[model samples]
Target: MADELIFYTHPQSRGRIARWALEEVGAAYETQVVEYGTTMKGEDYLGINPMGKVPAIVHKGRVVTECAAICAYLAEAFPEAGLAPTAEERADYYRWLFFAAGPVEQAVTNNFAKFEPSADQGRMFGYGNYDLAVDVLEKAVSAHPYIAGDRFTAADIYVGSAVGWGTMFGTLPKRDAFLDYFSRLSSREAYQRAGAKDDALAAELEAAKAPA
Candidate 1:
């Protein structure tokens, strides 16, 4: 179909976020698993995303990359899913959505790599410092039932995935607020479904790599 949505991802990456968002929006998408350093960087896949990364989607011949952008794009593209923000929810939606994508993502990755910014360098970095960025994120999740407002939206999928994965991997601190937020998201039927699909695929990939 001309409007078919094709999702390219690897089971073990941030692609899980995009998959969860797809499940939430209830979009029928075909998944293409690309191996890192191989098909992911090969000409065909790279043509879709020069970044040579997973978690990209092609819909109606238009490509969307980055998990956050994919979530936002899907929400708007399928408005019937009701994941898109309302006029009142727009501010908080975009605010925390980009906040998680930018500051939270940077802070968590830097912390994991043991790269702490000096006070002077902190001023230059967008997140200021890992500790400060996490503290702010804690407040954001605690302030609302969901990331954007009282209800679940596309923003939650991205922000919740960050918190969920961070806490799971020990990249982000296991604060009560962060734990509570992700707990709520993880219980969602769509989140569970997405997780099952990815987990099964991950197991299959691991099995293929094992000695036969």
Candidate 2:
């Protein structure tokens, strides 16, 4: 179909974030599960995403990779879902959205890998340092009901996923602000539905690998 939205993801990867966003926007998309290191790196899949990453969406024949971009694109594409931000909310929406995608993601991954940069190196990095990046993120979440202000927007999908996975996986500190922020987001019906779908797919994959 000309308007088909094809979602490429792995149940165990950050694709969960994009899945949630898709559910939020109520987009009718077809899911394609890609395994790590095998089909994910294969020529066919790599042709879709040169980076060989999951959570990519091909909508209306246009490819959108990166969880943040997917969320933003879906929101705009499905305005009836009201996931897009208003003019007043635009500043915080883009600010915190990219902040999570850039600084927070970099800081958390570097911290998890135990690669602390020196002061000089920190200056060269966009995140500065994990501690600084995390501290700023905590304040951002606590300042408002949602990342983009009082209303829920696509920005929350990206930022909330970071906070949710970070705290759950021990990559981020179990701060009250982080926990509270994620708690609110996790309660959304869309989030629950998306999670259930992914969990089921994960179980199927595991079962297929089990000895018959």
Candidate 3:
């Protein structure tokens, strides 16, 4: 496994996004499940990322963080998976990746965190307002079958997962396009494999914590 990818992650966190991306790339990854009290907050892992976040990756000793960066890196690294776009597709690739990770994520987190921004559009925030961000995403997804237009690339994995999770938790609107796109993404075999593993892991963790 010398050429293997090592992913440090906790299932329920933003790590889910990376998990889906890893599966899409079909990369050989070894998941190190980080327990909350004992491992996730440990000093060693914290040094790898001072933020103490999971979803960090160490592939061939090269470290990468941030969900969108990880997704983009994997797509580029595993070109055989067809997840990466051609040089021609780069603009749309970067655009949607950052859009989902930045605007979409910020809007959902803020809605959950109950954050309110000033009404002024001049404020250059990740998501100026929740509704505005929703409108932006609605128009994009509705415009095409996937975020990067007709291509089903890693950008969809990133953006589709965000849409799926957001709508699942009731933060996002249940628009027809978002619903249909999420349905297609969720039906993918790779997505199912990754999701099943995380579900089992979560169940095991919960069982271990069950009252005696």
Candidate 4:
């Protein structure tokens, strides 16, 4: 069906976020695992996402890229999932969704790349600085059970993924707030289901690359 979602991802990439969102929405989708380097850069996948990034989804012949965007798109596409909030309740939803995708993302990437903006340049950086960015995020998650008010919307998937991956990789500070939020998200059946498949796939890929 044209309405079916076509998900393009790599097991070990941020594609895991999209997989979790897809599971939450109970969407009818098929997965295409793109290999790193040559395969991702090839004409086929590049046509879907010019950036050659994983976690892109094609639905109804339309394409959506970026993890946050995919989560939001899926939430709307599958209203039955109730991942989207009404307009009155959307302020926090949109706020944290973009915050995680923008500032939180900038902070984490800079940390991973070992680049830090000095205090003088903090005003120029979208995330101010890594420490400041993480502190703000910690406060946000600590104040609420979910990213968007009381409901577990798609925003949680994006922000929760950031916290979960950050704590696991030691990229983001493992503050009590982040730890608590991650603990809740990790226990969800959808999260566990998606993680199990990704973990198995990641192991298989790693084993294939190991010296025989």
Candidate 5:
């Protein structure tokens, strides 16, 4: 039970974010890729994540779920990684981390599904509206090199993935700020290593499914 983390993920899911965080932690980990509609929702996996979601991790037999939560948990679980925020930067760190997980995520999901909340219900929704949520995120990233400040932290990994994926998929606008931030985050060595492994896994899965 010495620093053993079992990572449950699918190559094409939000597991990507967890993978990046895992790399950053530099902890000994074993990844189990859950196949969609199969092991993903299997009893074994479901027991670990009742929601049957990928990107869940079991460290020392404790389960952690959700992309953002897993990333935050990993930072604390492996403090030597220096991914957690300093006491002085905790506010900014928690603020934007949850902001991205909630508002930014809501905006992107709504856009992708083409679902619009009634205009009158804007006040009821955390994001208010897609454009407003995006604008707020834009301003946040634009104002700071890293989400919590000049230093890179787990918050950046989580938010950076949102901005990176949103921009690539056109769910969120590709503003200059988002592009620059994503570029910087994507250039990190850990990010690249995680991405390569996931990309290879995705390609292998695709190949396996191809008609011979």
Candidate 6:
């Protein structure tokens, strides 16, 4: 039956976000782990993603790539999950989701790397600067219960994943805003399950990398 959803990933990669979406939807899927320095560039997988990226899924004969795209697609595909927003809610959904992936992510990465951009907002990068980007997120998250506000939609899946990973990776500022949001997400059973899977696989890879 092809399992309906084929999660092509390297386990420890951004595929964890898509994996979280799958767990939230309670959708059945088959896992295909691609290893780095090896399986990531495999010929068979190249066609799946032109850039040879993980977190791509083949659902209902359509190939979906990019973490946020996969998350949005899966949420809508399986409406039973209630993780998708309606057309009226599209505005907020797209805003936070893409914001988290784009500006927020960039800022987190920049901060983690200690890359200080120009002080002039117009002269700086897409996220302006790390502090400004984090400030935007802090205010937004503190104001809304969820990314889309009120509902825990797939928007949170993307945003939460970013925040979760950012905090864990020591990228974003560890403010109350991030702590509160991460705590809220961590308490969800689906999140716990998805996180456990990512954690276990990460441990497996670490063991594999250790000196024999």
> Total clashing residue pairs per candidate?
0, 0, 0, 0, 0, 0
In model 2, which runs have C-alpha deviations exceeding 4 angstroms? 1-3
Can you write out model 4's per-residue Cα lDDT over 1-212, one digit (the tens) per residue?
Answer: 53477989999899999999999998778888899998789999999999998989999899999999999999999999999978866998999899999998988898899898988777888788988889989989987898877768999999999999899889987788999998989899999999998899889888988998
- Residue 88, candidate 6: Cα error in Å is 4.8
Better of 1 and 4 by lDDT: 1
What TM-score would every model get versus the actual structure? 0.97, 0.97, 0.93, 0.94, 0.96, 0.90
For 120-141, candidate 3 gives per-residue lDDT tens digits of: 6417785778988888888888
**In lDDT terms, how accurate is model 2?**
0.93
* Residue 67 lDDT (model 3): 86
lDDT of 1 by residue, 48-140 (tens): 999999899999889999999999999999999999999999999999999999998888888889999999988898899998989999999
Clashing pairs in 1: none
Clashing pairs in 6: none
lDDT of 3 at 205: 83
Please identify which of the two predictions, 3 or 6, would achieve the higher TM-score against the true structure: 3
Mark the regions of model 5 whose C-alpha exceeds 4 Å error after superposition. 1-3
Better of 3 and 5 by TM-score: 5
lDDT of 5 by residue, 124-168 (tens): 887889989999999999878999999899999999999999899
User: Which candidate, 5 or 6, would have the higher lDDT against the true structure?
Assistant: 5
Ranking by TM-score: 2, 1, 5, 4, 3, 6
lDDT per model vs. reference: 0.94, 0.93, 0.84, 0.90, 0.92, 0.84
Top of the candidates by lDDT: 1
